[model samples]
Target: MTVYALETSGLTKQFAGFTAVSDVGLRVRRHTIHGLIGPNGAGKSTCFNLLTKFLAPTRGTILYEGADISRAGPAEVARMGLARSFQISAVFPHLTALENVRAALQRRRGESFDFWRSDRILKRYDADARALMAEVGLTGWEETLAGEMPYGRKRALELATTLALAPKMLLLDEPLAGLGQEDVGRIAALIKRAAEGRTVLMVEHNLNVVASLCDVITVLTRGKILAEGDYAAVSANPAVQQAYLGEMAEPAHV
Candidate 1:
């Protein structure tokens, strides 16, 4: 088998004659956490969309587990054990945290979401759903409505639902965005735990979390790779430094 969990070659995306991602290649090793960081408008999100099949690439190839997935749809890729979380917390607002996770568990079992089904039919997923909730530190919030939960808790719940799919690879888009300092630390730790036995690809603006959690970091600027290495090596590169232009504050040690 392949050493890489995901790979892209000559990946390019253009919007109305403007190239957003140009001639990019990315490789993520198996069972490792890889971080993608760049300044605003660097096409990080666009690249992510292409990888997840939310947007079609203008030209390129994407391989997941050595199989060509460039032509696959989002749901197809997801069912193949590649799951993604959004920049915004995506939870069913009216559903309790446990129910939200149960919904995902149902999907994983290839069952249609029969909201009208009796509680007895749905109870089969409860144990697994609660386990996932506990995995993300939402044990006590199981009965709480997802929308009523605090922002940090909502993010945690989202992670729980994502985990219910039992994915082999996770694509997290800005997992630390809009978080307070305390919540940032908590969520970062959760992400670390989630990476166990799974490959993770994350796009985050939080430099400290990236430095501590990522096994490899790829720096992009103006939609192209500027440098790729460990945090120390990438941080020391003059080109990467110039690209950030002081936005790359010295990350605090975790």
Candidate 2:
């Protein structure tokens, strides 16, 4: 049996009178790309937050490498190698791409963000910062301010920063949310490369992208698991097809 990198049993979240996620169990294997997808209100985001420890679950046990982390805090989970990216860009707009990546590298090295540090202390991180920027295909734009970069590049920079953490499991919430058709492919390729030795669990709306990148997919609908399988199996599911009607175009079907 393959030991999963992450797992959830009876995962659930309740907000007042409504249940956002109910009795959800997920088994994300090691070093594979897995996707969570559904319609607008399918509790994808809620489940994501639960796994990332952004929100405490009302009831559930989250296991990471066989350890229960349901009670772990966000920072704890991050330090434990579970990192997440938000839907909105998470870069510092004023910082140059190199500077932004250098800062993240510095943080990972246990350096405080104290601005009083000398140039020598900061320069120590430059080489690695440059390599990370290049890893995300931001090599030539190193000196540009993050805000000045185009939207796609900005998203890449955000991903570069996330990579600085060197997480074992990465959670991306709508990684391709806002981009042109062109940028979508670029980011998708980047994601595939980033998943080389890490487990990635993503919540994405673009079914085509999901189809191409995901080794396995779990579909949620109305806060429940509608289907789970490879892209072809899930896409062929009658219930999944019915649930997606009107929510997404028919061409998105696999």
Candidate 3:
């Protein structure tokens, strides 16, 4: 078995004549949380789209669990146990928290979304859906409409839905993007709990969370890797320092 759950090599993406991501290689170890961080316009989102197959790479390959998935479509890769969450919370606005998660469970079973199915049939997924909700700290909010829930809770619900897929690797885009300070710790904790027995690749701007949570951090700048290492090593790199010079002198632990 390979040590990496996800790997990419010589990955490049070009828009018209401009390069968005160039010669990037990323390897995410099995069962570890890897952080991807960089300045705005650093190609983090583009790289993520390539990995998830939302956009085909102009060059190079993507491997998931040692299988080449470079040419696979998003749904195909998703069925292969690779799932991703968007920066924006994606949940059925009218669906209750439990229902949203149940829907995902049904999808994972290769069943068409049968929201109108008889309760007797849909009830089978209820227990598992509630458990997943509880896993993300949404136990008491089961009956609330996803859109009515607080932003942080909605993010958690999105996570529960992603977990319903039972992915081997998870790609989280800015999981903490819109969260307030208080909610940051809560969501970050949920992410930590979710990482158990799974590999996570996250693109985030909050360096403190990355400092605490990531086993390895890959820094990108101007469409290429600027530095990569544990928080201490990557934060100390002169190149990384210069890259974030005006924005942040250095990433500080809080």
Candidate 3 local lDDT, 1-254, one digit each (tens) = 99999999999999999999999999999999999999988999999999989999999999999999999999999999999999999999998999999999999999999999899999999999989988999899999999999999999999999999999889999999999898999999999999999999999999899999999999999899999999989888888888988444666766
Weakest ten-residue segment in model 2 by summed lDDT? 245-254
Q: Candidate 1, which segments miss by more than 4 Å at Cα?
A: 249-251
**C-alpha local distance difference test of each model:** 0.93, 0.90, 0.93
TM-score of 1: 0.98
CA RMSD of all predictions:
0.9, 1.7, 0.9
Lowest-sum lDDT 10-residue window in model 3: 245-254
What's the count of clashing pairs in each model shown? Answer: 0, 0, 0
Writing each residue's lDDT as its tens digit, candidate 1 over 1-254 gives 99999999999999999999998999999999999999999999999999999999999999999999999999999999999999999999999999999999999999999988999999989999988988999888989999999999999999999999999999999999998888998999999999999999999998989999999999988889889999989888888878888656464476
lDDT of 2 by residue, 70-168 (tens): 999998888888899999989988889998988888777777775568889788888999999999999899999998999999889989999998889
